[model samples]
Target: MSKLCLVTGANGHLGNTLVRALLAEGYRVRAGVRDTSDTEPFAGLDCQRVYVELLDEAALDRALDGVEVLFQVAAAFRHWSADPEADIITPNVQGTRLVLQAAARAGVERVVYVSSVAAVGHDGSALDETSWNEEVENPYYRSKILSERVAWEAAQALGLWMVSVLPSAMVGPNASRLTDTMGFLESIRQRQVPLAPDFHFNFVDVRDVAQGLIRAAQSGRAGQRYILANERSSSFADLLRAINAVSPGYRQPARAPRWLLMCVAWLQEAQAGLGGRPARLTRSQVRLFQGVRQEYDTGKARRELGFQPRPSDAVLREAFAYLWRRADQ
Candidate 1:
C-alpha cells in the first residue's frame, strides 16, 4: 500500500496543484477542504475528501488519521483586512499550532508547511533560507511569520518532523480560479492599473512550487526552510513588457512617482475605512515594495531537494496568455 498524504486547503491554487503532483507520484491523497461544494478543483482526481477546519481539533485529527505526510497549505492570504488580528492573525497562528499538535497526536510521519516569501525579508540583497522578516507591518506577512514560528515551536515540542517551503509570487496555468497573483496580471492585461509603481517582483510557476513542496517532503532536512522562487527579479516595467509580448494592444501604465502613489494608497485605505470596498492598494503594500527588488537564492532547495524553477519570463508569458484566454471566454 502507498503512503497516505493529507493536503489541507486542497481547493487553493497551490494546494490543488500539489494534490495533482502527489497523485502523479502514486500517493494516496486525502484532500482537506472547508467547502465540499467547491469541488471543481478535484474533478476527475481520485482522492478522499474531508472537511478541515484548522481551528477545530477534532476535524483535523479525523483528517490526519492514517496519514503519513501532512501538507499544511491553508492560511489567510490577504494584504489588507478590516480587523487584522481577528481576520488574519488568529486563524493563521492558532490554526497552525492546532494542526501541528493534531498531526503529532495522529502519528503523522512528516509535515510540509507552506510558507510565503512575505515571511522572508528582502533588504536589497539576495535572500536565503536564513533571512527572516522581523519588521513586518503588513498583517498577512506578520501572520505568516508568526504562524511559521508557532509551527516550528510545536514541531520541536511534539518531536514532529517538519519542513517549511517558502514560495514567491506564484503564477501558472490551470488555476481553479483567479488567484491574487493571476488577478494582478489580469488587471495589467485589462488596463485596470492606471499607474504602475516602481517595484521589482520574483515570479515562480505554481507547478514548480508544488513540485518543490513534494521534493521537500521527500528529501528536505527536518527543521529547515526552502525557498521556491526564481533566482533573479523582474522590474515592474519588465512585467509590462512581458504582458505586452503575450497579448498585444493593452498599453502599460505610466510609471508614477512614489509620493503620488503613496497618496493614492492612503486615499484608498481611507475609502475602505469608511465601510466601502476593500482597498486594492494599501499603504503597507506601497511601503513594502516601492523601489524595492524582491530576489532570493534557490541554491538551498536546488542542492538539497533538487528543485529547479522555470524562467520568470516563461512563467509570466504563460500566465498572461492564460489570463487572456480566460478573459475571452
Candidate 2:
C-alpha cells in the first residue's frame, strides 16, 4: 500500500508546507484540520481531509484511520492565556497524548512530532539536543516540555516509532493566519519595536523546516530529538536592519535598558491580571526577550539529516516581500 500520511494543522504555516512536500515524496495525503472546508491549498490535489480537533478522540479516529505516518504539529502557540496553565495543558499536552495513543492503536508506521525550540532548554552556553532548558517560566514552554515527555513515554510504552523536530524562530513567508515572525517584522516596520535585546536566535525558512520533517519521517531514528536551525544567529537589531533595507522609512529603535523593560513587564503582567487590555510588556513577553545572547548548534541535524538552511538575508528578503504585498492589500 502507498504511504498515507496524516498532517495535523494542515492549514497552518509549516503544516501546509509539510503536506506539499509529502505529496512530492509520493505519499497520499490526509489533512487533519478543524474544518475540512478550509482545505483551499490542497484543493487540486487528490487528498483526504477530515475535520478533527486534537482533543476530540472521535474526530482523531476519523482523521487517523489507516494512516501510516502522523505529523503532529497543532498546538496552542500564544504564551499568555487568560487561564495560563489551563490554556496550554489540555490542548498541547493532552492533545498530543490523544494523537500518540491513536497512532499506536492504528498501527501507524512512524510519528514526527513538531516541537518548538522554545521547549528546548537554553543552557548558558550553546544548546544542543542534549541540553535541557531549565528556566521554563511560561505556560507554553511548560506545556511543550510536558507534551514532548508524553510523546517519548508513549513511544516506549507502545513501541511506537517517533522523532521530535525542534525548530528555532522560523523565518519565512506563507499563508498562515498566525502572526509568528510577521508580528516581529510588523513591530519593526511601524517603529514600535523596543531597543534591540542582547539575545541572539537562529532562524530557518519554513521550507527547510518542512523538508526536515519529511527527512525525519523517512530516515530519523525513533525516540530521538533533533534541533533544526540555520547556521547564523541574528539579533533583534539585525532583524530591524534587514527590514529597513527592504522597507524605506523604517527607523531603528532607541536602546532601552533591560532593567527598565523588566519593570514594564511587571506592570503589564499586573494589568493583564486585573482583566485590563493588552499591554506592551508582560512576564511572558519579557521572558521571551531575556535570551538575547543564546545560540544553537544545528550541526547534528546538518550531519544526520542533510538539512541545509538558506541564508538569513534570503529569508528576510522573502518574508519582507510577502509582508509588503499583504500590507498593501
Candidate 3:
C-alpha cells in the first residue's frame, strides 16, 4: 500500500513545491492548509485537501489519523511584529509541538519537519546542522530555533521517528506575487532599492528543498539536522547585478551608505508600526548586515543525505524570469 503522507502548509511556497514532489514520488498526499477554500495553489493536483488549525488539538488529532508520514511544514514567518511572542513565536513553537504530539498519538511512522536556515544562524563561515542562530535577536529566527528544539524534544520523548530539514531562502517555481523575495526582485527591476543591504545568505530552489526534504526522511539520521542549502552566497549588489544582467529595463542600483540605510530602515519600521504591518527592513535585518558575512555549509547534507543543490545563478535566473513574466500581467 502507498504510504499516506500528510504535508501541512501545503498552500505555501515550499509546501506547495513539496506536495508536488511527494505526488511525483507516488505517495498518497493529503495537503493541509489553514484555509480549505483557498484551493488555487493546489488546483489540479492529485491530493486530498484538508484544513488544520495548528493550535486545535482535536483538529490535529483528526487529521493525523491513518497518516504514515507527517510533513509538519506550517509556521509563521513575519519579518517584523509589534508582538512577536504572541503573533509569531507562539504559532510556530506551539504548532510544531501539536503536530509532533498528534503524529505520535496517531502512530505515524516518521515526521519530516520543514525548517528554515534562519534556525542555523550564519556566521560568514561553514555551518553544520549543529549551528544555531542564538546570537541573532529576531522573532522569526527565534521561532525557528525554538520550534525545532521543541520538535526534537517531542520526537525523542514520544518515540516518534522525526527528521528535520533546514532549507535556505527557498526560491523556485510557483512563487507568489507578494513574497519578500518577489518584493525585492520587483524593487531591483524597478531600481527602487537605492542601496541594498550587504547581508548574505544561501538560496536553494524550492524543488531542490522539496527533494531534499524527502531524502531527509529516507536516509537522514533521527535527531540530526540536515541543511538543504546552496553552495553560493550572493550579496545584495551581486543580486541586483544578476537580475539586471538577466532582465531588461532594469537600472543598476546604487549602494547607499550604511548610516543612510539605517535611518531609512528606522523610518520603514516606524511606518510599518503605524500601519500595523511588518517592515521589509526590520531592525533585525539591519542588524544582521552589520555582522560578519552570513553563509552555510551543506557538505554534511551532500555527504550523508546524498543531497545535491543547483547553482544559485540558475535559481536566480528562473526567479527573474518568473518575476518578469508576472510584471507583464
Question: Candidate 1, overall lDDT?
Answer: 0.89
What's the distance in Å from true for residue 313, model 2? 2.8
Q: List model 1 lDDT by residue over 114-201, tens digit each.
A: 9888889776788998988995688988999999888999999999999999999998866777776777888788788898788788
Off by over 4 Å in 1: none
Task: Give the per-residue lDDT of model 2 (tens digit) for 1-329.
Answer: 67999999888778777888888878898987887787566766667778879888888887888899999988877666667677776789889888888888888999999987776766445778877665466777788888888888878898899999999777665555744455666666666665765556676788899999989888887888888876567777677667767876665566666686788778877787788554445566566656655467788888788888888777776777777777786
Best TM-score among the predictions, by candidate number: 1
Q: What TM-score would you give candidate 2 relative to the actual structure?
A: 0.92
Model 3: residues with Cα > 4 Å off, grouped in runs? none
Q: Global lDDT of each model?
A: 0.89, 0.77, 0.81
Task: Name the candidate that leads on lDDT.
Answer: 1
Candidate 3 positional error at 22, Å: 0.7
Q: After superposition, how far is residue 109 of candidate 1 from its true place, in Å?
A: 0.3
lDDT (C-alpha) at residue 14 in model 3: 81
RMSD of 3: 1.6
Candidate 3 clashes between residue pairs 3 or more apart in a chain or in different chains: none
Candidate 1 weakest lDDT stretch, 10 residues: 246-255
